[model samples]
Structure formats: structure tokens, C-alpha cells
Target chain A: MDEPEFIAALRSLPLHPGARNLEDDCALITIGNETLVINHEMMAEGTHFRPDADMADVAWKLVASNISDLAAKGAEPVGVLLGHSLGRDDARFLQGLKEALLAFNVPLLGGDTVTATGASTFAMTAIGRATHHPVPARRGAKLGDAVYVTGTIGRAMLGFEGAAHHRAAFDRPEPRLAEGLALAPLVSAIMDVSDGLLLDCWRMAKLNNQTFAIDPDAVPVADNARRDECMRWGDDYELLFTAAPGAAIPVAASRIGKVVAAGFAPLVLGKNAFPTADNLGYSHG
Target chain B: MDEPEFIAALRSLPLHPGARNLEDDCALITIGNETLVINHEMMAEGTHFRPDADMADVAWKLVASNISDLAAKGAEPVGVLLGHSLGRDDARFLQGLKEALLAFNVPLLGGDTVTATGASTFAMTAIGRATHHPVPARRGAKLGDAVYVTGTIGRAMLGFEGAAHHRAAFDRPEPRLAEGLALAPLVSAIMDVSDGLLLDCWRMAKLNNQTFAIDPDAVPVADNARRDECMRWGDDYELLFTAAPGAAIPVAASRIGKVVAAGFAPLVLGKNAFPTADNLGYSHG
Candidate 1:
């Protein structure tokens, strides 16, 4: 089976009620009065990074990407359990791990470590406590709602362009934990843009049975001359959500689009509609 | 850093107060009155299994090992979150994953999956609720305690000897969950022997600051001719424990040893003493 087929097969297995059919970024489980949000992510040498990539940065990216999912749920991190395959540059990897844990102020829970050969892999599970009720999901957007995003788009793609000053954006993109927590109480729908804004917006719209109509002039970009490329490229680690018009936004973000009634296309780029969501986004795989 | 150094470096990082400095096999956390046992394990190609090995068994072994950790803690399986790196044989892996979850009665929470180029790796987090107070750890053995192990030892080693009858023992070793729950309240110390019985005994002795004197003649083996080799070989999933001399030895285990006061050696093989735990067992690295 391929990735899609494999995932579909897994959907048939017995799952906890909190799993949400494996559609959401974070799984929700209620223990006592608290709602726990959990996310797990894995990164590898050849697939997620170059063989010669800085081990520290690789570790940082692993932690940040998982944390971003928690941020999308507006959850505060409890700790992370790590599973590591022993290989080269362990010292460098540890350094990067320390930096990310300290930067996010999340504790490191115990996990197993085993020695392995060929193509080292790293995985981590981040557990968090939800700060708001009815914890935000990507399918909660309403018709005629305003669409917004945190910070600018395409910074990671710019970092990939070999600019010395732009490198950290790609190496150590910060998860918007604070903004997510702030936005959770106000927004109807929210998710992080791990994939490109266009693709993620399309996903949110499709799940909500609405259409995201983004204005090319209003959408923020890393470089105005390459606007289309910036909107389509991903890895910016920005929060994207929908709120009622004139609602108070607690974080510094840009209002770039509106949620319209369901249409033939899930996403409309300017006046023209994309044929499919898959055709508009960049996939590292 | 190697495995030991890598673990030491992780100690310096900021962790939750309950992380226990990575001492216990599973991280212990209390949510309200519920004590949670969490463990994550990763298996890979080449190092963990043969590149050509059956993908289904590989997935089975991964889930069983983590479940074994829960069993050691006298905890019932709550659910598991899986982190998988995409590669070949995805269908077989999912089939095995389904079987293991059904066998153990565990729910699949949620996890992340990424496509990777080489060396497919699988990681899982098993969460459970403790059934007994002061959950068992390796550091609870006491002086003059009688040592026992549930079921016979070294059967897995015999499985490696081309015996079709014994092959299943090596392929899918059952975790002693029920036996552990039955023995938890009465035993002074208890642990599942994943490594060789001798090495695990030494580790428990060292952690408790005592010495274990085991009679080689009383120790059960797969065969008399291969007794010595069987005692040294690992992958036997049996519970090893210590209790008051004749405190109704609960399970169908043999009484093989006694825990003594602090001594120069942590383990005594018949009359000869082994200086360190690492020297007595297997090292896959």
C-alpha cells in the first residue's frame, strides 16, 4: 500500500474516541476537567533534511514542528517524550534538543534510545493541556468569516534561497504558541500552516464546506515580485484561522481573505480558481 | 555522544519534576488521582530487524515491547500513538499493527507519518493507568529477599536454533500483564526480563544497592546441553521478582535466587561473580 492507502487502512482500526478519525493535527482526550492535546512527529536524515545538514538544526525543526501542532490547538505544552535511533553527531543533536526545549519551556519526559544503523531517525511526542473549551478545529469556519494569518508567508522558502540572514527562518522556525493560545478564544477555526497557506486554507474550506476567496493584493509575501511563489510555498510555521469580521485579533496578523459559500473549488486565488488543492501546494516528499 | 553520554546530556535539559531523571523504564505522571505510565519505543531496518524480515512480525515486535513495559508497571493498556516513517510494505505493517492492537485491546490514539527515503522506522507511545500504588521499579529489591521468575527462561534462545516449535516464542513473546498485576502487591521488586535473566538481575541488584546470589542448577533453561548459552542469550519476556522467602510465590515461576546486603559484586553466577551488568548480557549495538 502507498501512503494514502496505508492511512486509509489504519482508519479502520480501533481508535480512542479522542482521535477524531485521525483528521485533526492533535488528538483530544479529556482527563478530569482538563483536555489534553497530543501530537507526535518524526524526522529523518534523507527525507526531512540533507545528510550533511546541521544535526542541531534538524533536532530543533523536529521539536518545533510538533509544537506548532499543539499551538494550533491552543494548548500549553506539558512535556515531550523522545525516541532516538543512535548514530553520528549525537552531541550536536542533543545541543539542538536542549535549545528547543529551553526556548519553548517544555519539559523532556523519558523515552527509549536504541542503537541502530543506516539513515538515523528522530521522533517526539508533545503533550499539552488545552486552555480553552471546545478546543479549536479546522472545520469550524463559518460562511462570510474573515481569514487571517500570523506573520508573513514564504520566509522559509526565502531561507532556502541561500541567503545567510534568511537561513534561521528555515532552520529554527518558532511555533506560535502564544498567538494560538490568544486566538483560540476568539477564532472559530484555526490551524498552523505547515503546508502552504493556499493548500491549508483549501483544506480548512473543504472540511468546513466553504470556499476561501483570497485577494492577491491583500495576501502578504516574502518578496512582492514573487507573490504567487510565496503563497504556494510552505514551511513558514504561521497560524491561519477564520474569525467574524471586525472581531478583535489578539496577535499581530494580516487579514488577507474571506470565507465564502461552498463553490466548485475550495480555494479561489484572486479571481481565478485552482483546479485542485493538491496542485497548488508544495510537498517536500 | 554514544548512548550513555547521549542520555546524560538529556539529563541536563529542563524536564518535568516527575520525569525521574530518566531512571524508570516508563515516565510516571499523575493526573488527578490517576497515575499514568508512558513509554515510547522505536525500531528500524537493519539494526532492529533483517531488511528482508517479514514486515508484519517487525510491527508486532514493536507494539509488544512497549506493552511489556506497561505490564512491568502493573498498568493496563489505555491507548497508543504511532509515529511512522513511510517506506515499503506499508500494507503488511498496518496488518500487524491491527493484530497487535486487537490482541492487547489497545486504542490507536493519533500520530504523525512522514515519507522517508531509506531505513523505515516505527515508534509508538503506550499510555496506561496504574492498577497499584507505588508502581514497581527496578530499585525496590531488599536484603534477604527470595528471587523468582514467572514461567521458564531461555525459550526464545531455543527459538533461534531452527526449531519450528520454538520459533513463535522469538517472533511474538507474550507480555506477562496478568501475572504482573497478580504479583504487584506482594512482591518487593518486579521487572520483565527483556535482556538476559542474568543481566536484568544484576541491574536490579545494582539499583537496589544489593547483591543477588542465584543457583545455576535451579535456573530453568531450554535444554541441559545449552544451559550456559541460554542463560546468556536475551529476548526472553518473563517477569523476574523478589519477595519474602515463602510469600505464596503467586505465578508458575521457579524460586532461583536471594537478594543479599550490599556486596562487591551485583550478580553471582553459581559461585563465580560477574562485576558488571553490561558484561553479563547481550548488546545489539
Candidate 2:
């Protein structure tokens, strides 16, 4: 509906516990002592994925990508709502979707579907449960805590270059749910490495009012091709987190760097944080 | 990215409550005490919307559509999550999205974003609360319950006929959030009117194991179309429900017909129920 109608509709809702009001009802998950709400993100063709990508991978990746967000927050994925275009509803596509849901353990609750007047578009809203473990908010890193990554980075980037055995990396990046769950109770703050390591690090730093200094040698690279390009390309789906210096990490986390009280914005040794602007993860309109 | 890797990535998720385990997650959100746990829906380009549609309206309609589902359950809208694709990150689009979030009074909690390989898509997961209400479900209509709908139907079908005013109806259909909330504690079973009247009614009947009969004359139609054509077209987004005989409806609900104990299939008042090989609702494959 138009803006007025939308406003009218929202105003019409009766307040529920924790909703406060319509404007605050973004995410509806119960996290820690509060509820986590969410909204919509639109994905467009030719940008979020390669047009020739396998239909099944497209469907699985779509669900996996969203579930990773909940994992980043250490929130347990509850259900998903989808806003899908018409072309992707064929039997093959649905088969892929079923596989993805089964694989991730996230259920398809309910949602709306419509036809398009142009290119296809897809969007989804995923809900999760927030528990006693810290919610791993973006703004909770401490000054002296060390920054760590749950798994290796750059594999997905290498796959983009057609490197041998790298195709799988690019096509399907793992969602660090276990690592997130294990780290949730320990990490000061956390986020997923969907964007390039350098860029995402900068984001965490800015959010925490801290800076990250990474030792290039210590950064885990899947292979040689990925060693360089992965620094620029994004979509690794690893967990980047910060923890206290003396803390014991539950997962097999690699020490990427140390969080400093103040420094040049999230640097990789002496270089600009991300080096590339246009290729900083994926952008949607 | 491919099927195997995609499956591996998805299989990596840890078990959670709503997920019910990573393998069988797509079940409809049905919680303890018969409480419908959540509402899910999807919006996609070229299927649910027009490319040239106003970004603000698109955002608003997206939220409205999902909320309407919760309203149908007579459940309180709790929060939402979004899945977005990256193609073009236009400032205007973000602005419109923010405006819709603010207008809807639902907070923009959290979501996932991925670059797409094809058209754009937007999906929403809206979790609602209905602890005390019997939580109107789709399969609750019984014999002799009156079939009814809140507001008009077939407007969206007619709205799709042209690129001007009619498109508005199609582009931005109002989600009767208030009407749904008002009726939540009242209806025997509830459902939103996304598919055409005949198709959705049939679905409701099937889900409830009852026969739903909608009088053709009682069906609502928009101004732009012929009677018969409109009858077949869906996208109305109204609330269709069944109530016990002599039960009073709070909103402007039209009395269509009654649920029958026998006659398992959904039927028109005078004609035989058409069992088409093809489903009548919009398919997103």
C-alpha cells in the first residue's frame, strides 16, 4: 500500500508485550531477556549471484545466507518468510529449496508471493531465538580484547577465480552456527564475514569504537589464489569476533588481531582496511 | 554455490527451537498450546510487484502483506526479519525501506543479504503473539460455519490490467491488519486472501477437512474487471474466514456460504468444484 495506508495499518495494531509500538516491531525473536526483530532485504539478479548459477545452489545459498545472519548474532534460527519472484517456483527450484531448508534446519513458515513486471527479485525475513548467552551485538567489543575468526577466509574468493576445487567454496560458503553458538557465551562482540575480511573488520571496529590490527601472515587463507584476492572479494561467511585477552575460546578460533582503544580505522598492518570499495561484499537496491 | 556444497553449508547449522532440527525445518510455525508461532511470506520482483513501482510503496506493501498474515491468525504481530539481494544499492531504495519500516511501526531488527544471480527478491518473516486467543488457524472451519471475507476482493487482479491507477491497486494492496486483529478472537478459522477466492477457500476447506461453499454472487469484485474474470483472479489480501451459524462478525464481512459436513472439495454454490491440474494461486517457480 501507499505510505498513508501503511501508517494507518501499523497504527491499527494492538500493542503486544515487548512490541512497545508498531515502529519497534522489527525483529520478534526472544533473545537473552529481550526480543530480536527484523525487517526485509531485497536481492536482485545479476548482482547477488551469477545468472548462470545452478538453480539449486541459488535456493540453498539464499536460505543459508539469511541463516548466517542469525548465527552472527548467536540467535537460534526459528523460521523464515520469503518474498519471491515467479520464475523461481519450478519443481527443480523447489526441490533445491526443500533441500536447503532440510540442510539448514530452518523451516519455511508462511509468506506472500507475487508476480513481477520486470526482472525477478527475492527477499526473506528470518526469525531466531535469543537466550541467556550474550546476543553478540555489534557494539560490545572491549578495548584490549583480541579479534578472532572462526574459520578460514578467502576460499569463496578463490573459487570465483576458477581455481581448482575452489568452485565449491564460492558456490557454498558455510554458515558458522556452531562456532557462533560456542562463541556466543565468550566473545565480547561478533559478526559474520559476509563482506571482505578487511571491510568487515573495519565495520566491527567502528561499531565497537575500537580498531583492529591484523598480521597478514596470521590471516588464514584457503590457498594461494585466495591469499591475495580474498582480501578484496567478500562472502566467506565466517565469524569474526572479539574476546578478552585471557579468555578461553570454545571454538577453534584463529587469532586474527588485537583490538586497540584507538588507531587508524581497522588496518591490515599498514594498509587501508579493505583496499577496494566497489567489491566490498554485495550491494542491493 | 552448487548443490552439494550448498547442502553442506546448510547442513552445518546447529539445531534450534523453531528450526526443529536443520533437516525438517520448513514446517508451518505451530507452537505449543495450538498457538501459531509465526507468519511467513515472500515478495518478489516481476511476480508480486512492478519494477517501476515506487520504492516506498514496495517497502510499505511488503510489511503490510506479512502483517496481514498475522492478522488473519488473529495473532498479534511481534517482529519481522528481512532477506535482501544485492544488485544496485540505491540510496532512494534504502530511504523508502526505512520509511516503510518507520510507518509500519515495526522495528528493523535484523536480516540477511546476498547478491543475486537473477531478478531481485524480498522475503519477510513476521512472528506474532497470540498466547490466549485460540489462535485462528486455517483448518478450524466446521460444518455450518458461515464463509466470509473482510473488505473487497479481486481488486489486485483488475489493478494489474494497466500501468497507471489500476497498478496502484496491484502494486500496493492494503493489509487489513486491524480488521484481522479485530476478528482474531472471533473467527472459527482464518486466512488471508492472497490467492483467488475460490482457490484459498478450497485450501482452507481442505486444511480443515470441511467443505467450503462460496456463493458466486456474494464474491467481491473490483471496479475495473468483468465479473467472471475477477472471480478467477486473486491478490486481494483480504481476510476470509468461517464462523458458526448466527455468529456476529465485527468487520464488514460478506456472508458467502456455509461449510458442509460432507462434500469434501470446495465448491461454488451452483457449479461443481473444478479440480484443475494446475493450482489456481500464483506460483513463484
Candidate 3:
């Protein structure tokens, strides 16, 4: 079975009240008056990170990726539990871990470690408390809502396309925590652009039963040479959200599209529906 | 750096209050009136389980080991987030995962999955709610407290030794959840005996600043012929705790020793102090 099939099987079984159908980026459960946000992300050798990548950078990326999920929901991190499989050298990983924890001001609560044979896998589960009740979800986008992206999408795409080896985008994509927190109370829907803006926008529109009329000329790209590639490329780790048209956005972002009535497709380029085969963002098979 | 050195480095960083110096079994965080217990454990191929082991059993053991930690703290599992790396056969692993989830009656929350090459590693983070306030800890044993152990020791050890191939003992050792809930209010300190009883006892004593004077004759062994070996072996997921002398004991456990004042050694056999070279538990180097 594949990953999506495995998740579908789990959904059929008994899941907790916080599971969210395994669709959202984070699980939400109310312990008392506060709602706790939790997420688990796994990074594997050879697949998620380059085999020759530095262990420290890999460690940083692992933590950053999980935290980004919380940021999408506008939750403040409480702590994290790290499940680490030791690699060839652990000192560099430790250095990177310490740096990430310090940089984020998050604590390493507890975790277990084991040695691996072939490839190493690291897992991080970040626990956060919701800053806003009814945390924003991808399905809340409404008709006529304006779509916005926090940062340039094509930087990571360019980085992946041999421009400095994606050092700025893939190696250390920042979680828009502050922007997420600031936008949580104001936006109709919010999500992180990890798997590419165009794909993620399609996801939000499909899940919300709305059509996103995006103008390729309006969508911010790092380079105009490959606008389509940059729009479909992922790993940018920016915030993609929707607000009322002309609403004052608290964060610096580009107004890329508008939420329209459901049409033949969830996404379009200036009223022309984009093909599913090419319009969607990056997805792991 | 080694495991101990790696942990020590984490201690130097800015950690959350719940981190507990990475010494306790789980991270304890009280949200409002409830205490939520969290833990993350990673199991690897070759190091944690035999390469020839069944994928279903590997999945079962992964969940069981994590829930066992919650049992030690006298907490009931709330839910779990699984960080899975695709293995040799996913169907078998899913079957085991389903059986284990049903057996424990815990919910499956959201998590991430990734593909891996070579040997695979899987991790699980268990979230539990404390049934008893002032939840038990490894450092709560007091002088003159009676040390008790649940179930039988060295069963997993003998199974690991390939003697009789203790299938039930090693494959599905009970977590003693019921006994833990019954004894949580009465116990002074408690923890799961994943390692050998002797090594774990020494750890509890050293952490609590007390000494344990254990009688080998009183310690229960799976096989009397290998009593010494059993005391040094681990993988026995049983509850080992200390309680007030003569307090209404609610669980069936054999009293193996008594807590004493600080001495030259943390643990002793009868009147002689045990050597650390062999008495310590199985530690990752």
C-alpha cells in the first residue's frame, strides 16, 4: 500500500477527537479551555534530504518543517519531542538541533534515539497552543475572498533549479509564525505553501468547494523566465491565505488571486482553467 | 558525541519547563487542571529489532513500547501520532498497527510518512492524561520505601536468549495498565522496567539520592537457573515502583528491596555493593 492508502485505512479505524480526518496539517484537541495543536513530520535520508547534506542543516529543516504546520494554524509552540535515528556523525546534528531550538525559543521536551543500518530517519512532533479559537483551516475560503501569499514562491524553485542549490529556500525556509499569528484573526482561511503555491491553492479551493481565479501575471515569482515552473514548485514554506477583497493585510504579501464560484476546475489562469496534470502543486506519490 | 554527551548538550540549551533534563520517562506538562504526558520513541532495524522479525510485530512492539512508558506514569493513553517510514511490506505492518491500536483503545491522530531506502526506522509519540495528581516519578523513592516489581522479570531476557523463544513474553508483554492505575495513588515513585530490574533499580536509586538493598533470593526470576543473568537482562516491560511501607497495596507485586540512605553505591545485592560493569542496564553506546 502507498502512503495515502495507509492514511485512508487509519481514518476508517478509531481515531481520537483531535484527528481532523487526517487531512489538516495539525491535530486539534481541547484539553481544558485551551486547544492544543499537534503535528508529526518525518524526514528520511535519500528522500527528504540529500545523502551528502550536512546533518546539522538536515536537523534544522526537520524542526522547521514541523513548526511550519503549527504556524499555518496560528499556534504558538509549547515544546517538541524528537525521534532521532543516529547517523554517521551525531555531533553536527546535535549542533543543528541546539541551534534550531535556540533560534525558535522552543524546548526539547523528550525523545528516544536508536541507531540505523542503511538510511536514517528523524521525526519531530511539535505541540502548540492555539492563539485563536476556531483555528483557520484550508476549507474556510469563501467566494470572492482575495488570495494572498506571504513571500515570493519561485525562490525555492530557483534554489532547486541550481541557483545556489536552494540554500535560502530548501535548506532553511523560515516558518511564518508571526505572520500566521497576525493573520489568524483576520483571514478567512490560512495554510502554508510547502507543496507549492499553485498546488496548495488548488487544494484549498477544492476542499472549500470554491474556484480560485489566479492571474499568472499577478502571482509573484522569483524569476519570470520560469513562472509556471515556479508556481508549481514547492518547499517555499510561505503562508497562503484569503481575506476580504481590499482588506488591509497585516503582513507583507502579494495578492495573487480571488476565490470565485466553483467551476470546471478548482484553479485557473486568468479565467482559463489549468489542466489538472500541470496546474497542481508538488505531491509525494 | 555519544548519547550521554548529546543529552547533556540539550540540557545546556533553553529548554521548556516540562523537558525535565530529559531524565524522566515522559515530558510532564499541565494544561489548566489536567496533566498531559508526552513521549517520543524511535525504533530502528538491526539495533532495535532483528532483521528477520515480522513487520506486523515490529509495528505492535513500537506502539507497545511507547504506551508502556505512559503506563509507568499511571496515565491512560489519550491518543498517538505515528511517524512511519515505508518498510518491506506495508500491509503486514498496517495489520499489526490496527491490532495494537484496538488492543490499547487509543486514537490515531495525524502524522507524516516518508519513503526510505535500506533499513527502515519508525517512531511513535504517545499522549496521555494523568489519572493521578502529582504523577509518579523515578526520583520519588524515599528512605525505607519498599521497592516492588510487577509481573515476572527476565522473561524477555530468556526470550532474547533464544531459550524456549518466549513468544508471548517478548512479542506481546502486557503493559500492566490496570495495575498501574490502581497503584498510582499509593506509590512513592514508579517507572517501567524496560531494562533489567537491577540496572533500573540502580537508576531510580541514583536519581533519588538513595540506596537500594535488594535480596536476590526475594527477586522473582523467570528461570531460577539463570537468576543472575535475568537480573542483568532487559526488554521486560513491567512496572517497578517504590511505595510507603505497609500502605494499603492495591496491586500484586513482589517486594524485592527497601530504599536506604545514600551509600557508596546506588544499589547492592544483600550486603555487598554490585559492580557497575555488569549491573548497569543495556545502554546505547
lDDT (Cα) of model 3: 0.84
Question: In angstroms, how far off is A44's CA in candidate 2?
Answer: 4.3
DockQ values, each candidate = 0.72, 0.28, 0.70
Report the CA-based lDDT of candidate 1 relative to the real structure.
Answer: 0.85
Question: Candidate 1: where is the Cα deviation over 4 Å?
Answer: none
Docking class of 3: medium
Candidate 3, residues B1-285: lDDT per residue as tens digits? Answer: 566676776677667778788889799889999999888888888888888888888888888888999998889999999888775687888888888899988889878877888888888999999999998888789899998998888898777666676766787666778888888899999999887888899988888888899998898899999888888788888899999888878877999999989888889888779535354677742
Write down the lDDT of every candidate, Cα atoms only. 0.85, 0.63, 0.84
What is the per-residue lDDT of model 2 for residues A218-275, given as tens digits with 9 covering 90 to 100?
A: 7888875446566556778888888999999888878978887666554445454643
Top candidate, metric DockQ: 1
Which stretches of model 2 miss by more than 4 angstroms? A1-28, A31-44, A81-103, A110-124, A162-167, A224-226, A268-285, B1-37, B83-104, B112-120, B154-172, B219-230, B271-285
Flag regions of model 3 displaced more than 4 Å: A160-166, A271-279, B159-165, B275-279
Q: Estimate each model's TM-score.
A: 0.96, 0.77, 0.95
DockQ (C-alpha) of model 3?
Answer: 0.70
TM-score quality measure for candidate 1: 0.96
Best by TM-score: 1
Question: Regarding TM-score, does 1 or 2 come out ahead?
Answer: 1
Error of 3 at B113 (Å): 0.8
Clashes of each: 0, 79, 2
- lDDT top scorer: 1
